[model samples]
Each structure stands twice: as structure tokens, then as C-alpha cells.
Target: MAFRPAQYAALLLGALTLSACARSPAENPQERSVIQNEDPFVAAMDEATNAAAAADRSARKTPSKPQQSDAPRVDTTAPKLSPAELRQRILRLTAGLQSAADTEAERVSRFLGVSFTPELMSIREGESIGDLEQVGSYRVSVSRIDRTAPGKHVRISFGPAGFSTGRPSICTFELAEFADALRSQGYDAGEVHLPHREQWGFVRYVSASDLTFYVSAELYRANDGTRSGKLCLADVTADAVKGRQ
Candidate 1:
């Protein structure tokens, strides 16, 4: 798994993807032959926003009794949290160390009764470490404190699990509403790295100050016609600001 931006389909994580030296299959043991032999992490992200259906198959088999614990839990994906609240939560999830940082990730882990592996899992290429856990509705992939560059960063991505069958726990977020929420909180309008459809019509990638979110054009069209969608993939990294507009 060579750590490079061109390798990934989208605008790869600014410093996380391409900064590291070339890597090997040993570095990505969990790697699987996916669409276009594309990186599973990236593919997982692209597929997150997709509402299309998959081939009918047998359901996934999970442990009967998984990580059971009496811990307070919260699903940040749920639309319940105000975008402003979710912003703070994104900060909380990536705040400390691994599971020890244990704010949102721990809540998700505890709620699903699935604990992160003791050993760090290589995610989104390079050695940007984190955990991989799957439960009933969603697949959870998160990066540990990103030490590759200087910043408080966490890359989190969630997609509907293969076994999922329209689970209510899945967060169904409308892009416009969520974006507006962040904007109201003083976040910028967003910098488009890759715009789909037309010029600023819809964006595949957008960054605001220290925050960046990637989505498809279907969420909001050129005429500002918004659609019903949820945030399937998101990379939340809090880094230094290059001054403000």
C-alpha cells in the first residue's frame, strides 16, 4: 500500500495519505481485492454516500455476545446532535488517544458492544493508525491521534454494513441542513477541492478552515435544489488555520 494521493480516488487526506514513504502488502495485511483493486479504505468511503443497493446475499454473521459493558454511549451520526454539537463531538472523538480518548468513539464502541482492537489497525494507507469495528448497522473506521503531521486530527468513516437492512440507528443527514448548521456556527462556506456537476453546483470535496467533509453532488444541486441524503463518509481533522477570510 503505497501512501500517495493519486492512488486514492478522491482528494486524499492532505498529509496523511501521501506523506509516508512507500509501503508493502505487509503494511496492509487486511487489504482485499475490491472495485478496481482500489484501496478498501477509500472505496469504503466512496461507497458510504452511495444509496444504491447491493446484490442480494446472505446476512452477516456476528458474535452472539460481543463487547458488553455498562458504559454511557452516544451515536454522533444520529441527527439528534446539532451540527454545532456534532462539531464539538468530532473534536471530542479525536481528542485524546485511542480508545482511551473514549468520548464519541468509546460511546459508539460501548453502544455497539464492539471494542477496538488492542493493536492499531492501519487505515486509509500509510501508518495512520486506528481501529476497524463492525456491528449491526454501520462499519466504523477511525484514525488514532494523527501524529504524521502536527495537528489534532481523526479520520472517521462509516458506511452501511453489508448485513444492514435499513437500521434506524444509521444517521440520515441532509447535507444542506448539516452544512448550514456548521456555517451558522462561524465555519466558512467551504473550499472546493473537487467540484462535480458544474462550477460550484455540487462538490465532491469541500474544506472549511480546519474541517473538511466529502460528499456527492446528489445532496445539493447547482440551483440549490437539495436532496435527501446522509453523511456516509467524513474525515474530521483539526489543524492550524492559515488565517481567516
Candidate 2:
């Protein structure tokens, strides 16, 4: 199918409509013709999606001040060092990923389980990239903040049913497995609760230096009764995660 964000929004809206009884096909030929013609509902959704896309584009285009860092830059072109020191430097530099160099192209292809171009992706200050991805029956969205800074953050979320029921599919298990992978990478992992209204699925939070991660099931419900339980993860700098006083 075409990579139409409007269509995707429409399908999501369709799920909500599907939850309730749809109009009977035998209602009338006129009703069928109306359905075949332009749908006001779908058009509204398309407009909303387009507005959001434009806003995102504008945000990315508006330049932001460069990040200020207190830590010294890593010596990638360093003199020879002992094995232990070299490993330590590697860990520090990648405390949360030291760089994100993708810009120019509004869209780029990268592997995050499945190979797909990021149509709804944002790269800001040439330092961070954030995007939402739909992988088969799953939806994955992630953000890596402050790449060039010594202490950056990466957030990832994996959800089942990117295009179907709100209930989780096979991707539920993948959520936990991905958390395990983070643990294997030496992150401090734990489960955390979201606000009361958002407490609908599994949620895990991980922290490592400048990076903090959140893994949880999607907890979005459409007013029309469409529900979803997609897994999601987020890794971010501590400062970014912190609230302003």
C-alpha cells in the first residue's frame, strides 16, 4: 500500500468505527454511494494528520541553539591507550550514543526490526533523530536526544497491532526481549508506572548515565472505541527527562 499518513490515520479511525456496528450494506444504494464518495470523517482525519506533519516539519526547520556540554570531547584520534582505558572511553563516549549525523534528506531508511523509510521522522540540530515506524503488526517509535553531547538519551517503544485491534499481538513478547537486550548492554532496567489514565499495559524504565529508557505497551484509546496495546521504548538524557522547576 502507499505510505499515506492520512490513510493511516483513516485506518486507525476505521478501527474505532469497526468497534461499533457498521451501517448495513443493504441500507440503500444511496448510502453505498455516499460511502463510496468522499467521507467527511476520513477527510477530517486527513486534515488533522497533515496539520501535524506540517507542524513537525516547521519544528525541525526552526533552528535551535547548539547544545552546551560540560564534559570534554572523547579523543577518537587518541594516542595509544591501555585496553582498560580504551574500553572505558568507549563506554563513556557511547554512554547514550555520542552522535546522530542524519539530515539533508527528509526521509531515510534504517533497520529497526524491519527495513522501512521514516516518513514521519524528525532530525533536529543535526544532533538527534526521532521517528515513528510501523513494522508488520507492530509499531516502533524511538528518539535519540543529544547525540553529540557526552550524555545523550535514547527512547524506544514497541507496540503490537500497528494497524489492527488495540489488544497486543505476538509483539508483546518482543517487548520484554528488547528490554533484555538493553540489560545485556549494561543498562539499569526496572518497571515503572505511568499516570493513572495511561496504566493499561506493561511499562519498563531503564537508566544508564545520560540515557534513560522506557518500554511499555501502547495505551491509546480512540473516543470511537478503538483500543491498542503496542509496546514502546524511550531512551533520553536525564535532563530531558527531568521536569522544569
lDDT of every model, 2 decimals = 0.33, 0.33
Off by more than 4 A, model 2: 1-96, 99-158, 162-166, 197-245
The residue-by-residue lDDT of candidate 2 on 90-114, one tens digit each, is 2332233312321111111121212
Error of 1 at 123 (Å): 8.9
For 1-245, candidate 1 gives per-residue lDDT tens digits of 12222322243344435546443333343543443156665556546534233322222343356657876633334333333344344433333222223323445444333344422344321111222232222223334334543222233333324313332333323345645644444344343334341111111112333322222211221122235333332233333212121
> Cα miss at 145, model 1 (Å)?
8.2
> Each model's TM-score, in the order given?
0.33, 0.28
- What residue pairs are clashing in model 1? none
The segments of candidate 1 whose C-alpha lies over 4 angstroms from its true place after superposition are 1-13, 19-136, 139-148, 161-171, 195-245
lDDT of 1: 0.33
